[model samples]
Target: MREADRTTRQRLADALRAEPATPSELAAQFDLTPNAVLGHVEHISRSLDRSDERFLVAPPTCRDCGFDDFDDLLNLPSRCPGCKSEAVTEPTFTIE
Candidate 1:
C-alpha cells in the first residue's frame, strides 16, 4: 500500500479504536466524502495485517435507502425505502 493509504488506515484504526464510528462520522472528522471514508475503511481492512481478525467490522447502514450509516447530521437520509421508511430509523451493521 502507498504511504498515504497506510497513514489513512492507521488513522482510521485509531479512530475506530477510540469509538465505533459510522463511515460518515469518520468522513466528517477527516473532512472526506462518505464514499471516500468507506473506501478508506475498506482499503484499511484489505491492507492491514490481521484484518480478518481485527478489522472485520463495518459501519452502520440505514435500512431504508440502504445508505451507509453515519453519526453526523447530514448523512442520515430523511427516510429509507429499500427496507422501508420504518426500518430507516434503525441501523444495520455491514461487515463485508
Candidate 2:
C-alpha cells in the first residue's frame, strides 16, 4: 500500500476506535468523500475480523417509521420501506 493510504487508514481506524461515527461524519473529519470513508472502514472491518476486536455497526433507521432491517449495513438506504420516507439515517461504525 502507498504510505499515504496506509497512514489514512491507520488514522481512520484510530478515529473509529475512539468513537462511533457515521460515514458522513468520518468523511468530514478526514476531509474525504463518504464513499472513501466507507472503503477505509471496510478494510478496517476486515482487519479487525482476524483479531479479538470486532467491527461494530449500528444500522441505519428510517426517521419516519423507525424501520431498520437493512440487509447491508455498509451502505445507507435511500428510503424507508415501512413508510416510504426518504429521511433515512446513515449507519454508524465503530471498533470494539
Candidate 3:
C-alpha cells in the first residue's frame, strides 16, 4: 500500500483499538465512504495475519443463538445446530 494508505490504516486501527467502531463510523470519522473503510479493514486484517484474529472480515458466528464471535470466543456453533435457533448473529460493520 502507499504511504498515505498505510497512515490511514494505522489511524483506523488506532481508532478501533480505542473502541470497537463499526465501518460506517470509521468512514464518517475519516471522511470516507463505508465501502472504502471496509476495503481498508480487509487489507489490514490480511496484513496482520495473526492467528488470534479470526472474524476480522466475515464475522463467523453461530447460526442459531445469535451469539457473537470475535477474538475472545473461538468456538461457536455453525448453524445453532444444537438449538435449532437459526437466529444467527452477524457482525455489525456499519453504525447505522
Q: lDDT: which candidate is best?
A: 2
lDDT of 1 by residue, 27-78 (tens): 7788888777766776666666646545545434565466654553323444
lDDT of 2 at 79: 89
Which numbered prediction scores highest in TM-score against the true structure? 2
Query: Each model's C-alpha lDDT?
Result: 0.57, 0.90, 0.57
lDDT of 2 by residue, 1-96 (tens): 564666888989889899999999999998999989988888889988899999999999998888999888998678888899999999999888
The residue-by-residue lDDT of candidate 3 on 1-96, one tens digit each, is 564666887787767656666666777899998778767776666656763543343454565454454452222233554466656553443110
Q: Between prediction 1 and prediction 3, which has the larger TM-score?
A: 1
Models ranked on lDDT: 2, 3, 1
lDDT of 2 at 69: 95
Q: What are the RMSD figures for all models against the true structure?
A: 7.3, 2.7, 7.8
Off by over 4 Å in 3: 1-6, 50-96
If ranked by TM-score, best first, what sequence of candidates would result?
Answer: 2, 1, 3
TM-score of each: 0.53, 0.89, 0.50
Off by over 4 Å in 1: 1-6, 49-53, 58-96
Given candidate 1, what's the lDDT at residue 23?
66
Model 3 residue 80 CA deviation (Å) reads 17
